[model samples]
Target: MKQKLGNIFGIISIISAVLYAVFFSLSRKQFTETFLVYSLLFLCLYAFYKLSKHAFHVNYRFLSKKWSGRFFNSDVLVLVLAVGVICRLLLLTYTPNLSQDFFRFIWDGNQLLAGYNPYLYLPDEVMRSGASPIPNAAFLHANMGELSSGHYTNYPPLNQLVFAAAAFLGGKSIFATMLWMRIFIIIADVGIFFYGLKLLKLLGKSPYLILLYFLNPFVIIELTGNLHFDGMVSFLLLLSVYHLLKSQQIKTALFLAYGVLLKLLPLIVLPLLFKKLQWKRASLLCLAVGAIVLIGFLPFYSSDLIEKYSGSVALWFGDFEFNASVYYLIRAIGYEFTGYNVIETAGIVLPMITFLSVLLIALKRKNEIPEVLLSSIVFSFFVYLFLSTTVHPWYLTIPLLFSVFTRYRFMLVWSFVVFLSYYTYSNSQFTENLVLVGLEYTVVAAVFLWEVIFFDKNNLQKTKLNSL
Candidate 1:
């Protein structure tokens, strides 16, 4: 009966997920009703799985004990992952028009293809003209209200380059562009997992860690559900770090630069790098890579890269509304901001404080660079969270991913919880307001404090020993 129930739960989970994906794909937007139904289904499945575990007399011990002889192996994990991947592919194929700012990408790509600078025209102007040099109709409609008559795209040209490539291959069909772009993300997802596992193995980690990340709903939903290129950025960052540890310093620097070119945030890791290796070697290598990235990005990219990037980063300070952070205190003070200017200002000042302070402490003690990098990453993520104008659920993944190296189990659990918070914003029934956002941040703050103040020493010791 227990085994049967477990099977039943598994089947239900899969069916409900597929149903949600199918409905979302067809609708072109998430259906509040459908999402609610899917959430209920998942909760029910979770309950059933718990019941099955007890009834089947399955080993209740942790990964320390092997429960079902074959259930924990790589082959089983691979099969489970395959199902997840296939489901994502199916959903991507069916999902209606592009999501979020994908239409902007199409618009920008169209501009680029026509020899018009995307940064020069507002989306409204492009749509008003109705001259689709790129061919996706949805792109025209999506900009109807977004263009304030003078709004230019702030996205860097690299992403637009990818979109242009997809449009070139797929012609004017939105679906075709989505399909090709999504395929790249799908490949990136798989590559991230494979290389992530390789890095863990190199560090002598158990295969369970691989299963944890690969099977994570957060990863599945983010990479597949949203089809974000963040997966590719993540893969490159991890691969670069892996090479760095192997003493392939020059190649590692190049990869890091490449990662930054894909997404600029990875450049933050470079500062931490200079402190890691011999200052001369690290500086030269990083500079060389920076120069290469600039050459690639310079011509098509905006000259106001810093200002534009800062404007985007400025969005974080608009309020203290999201799951957990010191920003709650800031918002509580009743400071009003139209954008994250205050937060951006604070971020600029505060990160320097945290980084310099931590660097001094770590250098004084001669701590391993990995430990410093982990600390820097965590601090940078928090600063971003605290001042960020937009606090998407997946943003938490950046910090949480690095915590794995620190042997921070609490962070893993917190990551899953934060991942689950996707439902909060996702729940179309309830308007996402400060109260709800506050609750989410409250949980995140509690979790962060627990990990930092209470668990840091123990986890660090464990990680140190494991590395040795």
Candidate 2:
């Protein structure tokens, strides 16, 4: 018995070591590095993750030792979290390699600290006028990419406020600003680790499932290494749902509104409230959320804020395309018929489909119960991404949060294959290979279909199969 537990513990340690090495490598490697190297390392990291997950479940489900045992579960949980933090600390000082969005992050932050509205001032115009308004404006404008430099920042007010705080604390040193920002992100991740565990337990799930998100290589790389704040958004979203399930309506409204201010994506889940809380309570919740969101935006309000922000967002649908699934097929068909890219039409149409799909899922799915509500939220996000004209890799963080509560595993699968879309960055043209895109989506779609169609007989949820 000791030997068996020791072996499982050994596997867990080995998984953590490999994850450390993988993140160390990713922090040093640029996106321009060969796609083969990125794919190989990511695939290898994922293999260990799967192995560790299997080992964990096998030890818990079959062994006489209770995975719920206070000492055992506590030690393993600490090991999982300590590794997660160690992996993040390794990249705390490194510049973001996977995305240049952080350059714009600092740009926005400095703008706020400098008393300039990020949404009102365009980086390109700020630079061309020979005015160095923001600290390190020259370097930031040069590297923030033409697409971002030309437009007003679309990051929400709370997000920009975070950036502002970093800018104020970091002074003129980009590394310092980055460090502060990374610290915030890491703290948010830690919050997610604890809240996610609590939420799983509240949902009657095995708390061990939080490891699926906490220790994911994809999450560590994207959210921590790349300095994206989707982790913060995820944390807030989780808190909102946690409180909502406990019938703490005011707390739920506050957290959900904060999440919406951080990133408007959480708005999609509002439809679920109608079914779960019913029309009257849900309507009041929506009104409360709306008031909070309005207050968040009021501090930075201007006539141009809405128009500029909406136009910048519209670019994602009308002008940009990447890692898309159904929209790509529809795009190819449009090309065949009209000999022109139809993102303009598809962008408008696909969102309508996504909204209606969300409505259908919210209304049709059995969501009055907490478990079904959680799963229904995941299903809606899946449909939204399925029909979205643009699907960034970090966008998967939403569904990944729900996987701990539900049987859906496609989010984990997608996290692995989504790196294939990075093949475009390997070259100067930054051209996406449709073949890689198709292959990535094909695997994700297949797994999604299978998981949605069939429940795992031995699903390591909250079930007790002690007689087995």
Among these predictions, the greatest lDDT belongs to: 2
Number of clashes in every candidate structure? Answer: 10, 0
Each model's lDDT: 0.58, 0.82
* RMSD in Å for all candidates: 6.2, 4.4
Where in model 1 is the C-alpha error above 4 Å?
1-73, 96-99, 128-132, 137-150, 301-325, 334-376, 409-431, 457-468
Query: Residue 249, candidate 2: how far off, in angstroms?
Result: 0.7
Q: Model 2 misses residue 461 by how many Å?
A: 19
By summed lDDT, the worst window of 10 consecutive residues in model 2 runs over 27-36
Q: lDDT of candidate 1?
A: 0.58
Residue-level lDDT tens digits of model 2 in 189-301:
99999998888778777666777888777788889888899999999999999999999999999999999999999999899989778899999999999999999999889
Tens digits of lDDT, candidate 1, 1-468: 535654664675577466546545433234455345445534543453354335435433222334434553333334445555665676676543223555666556666777866655556555678664546544454643343224555555466687777777767777787678788777877776677666767776654355344544555555556556666777778878878878888779777877777677676566566666768987798788778787766766566655555454444433233453454455454356543335545545555665565455435533345655665665665655555445565565556566666555444555444543444435445344455456656676677788777787787899999999
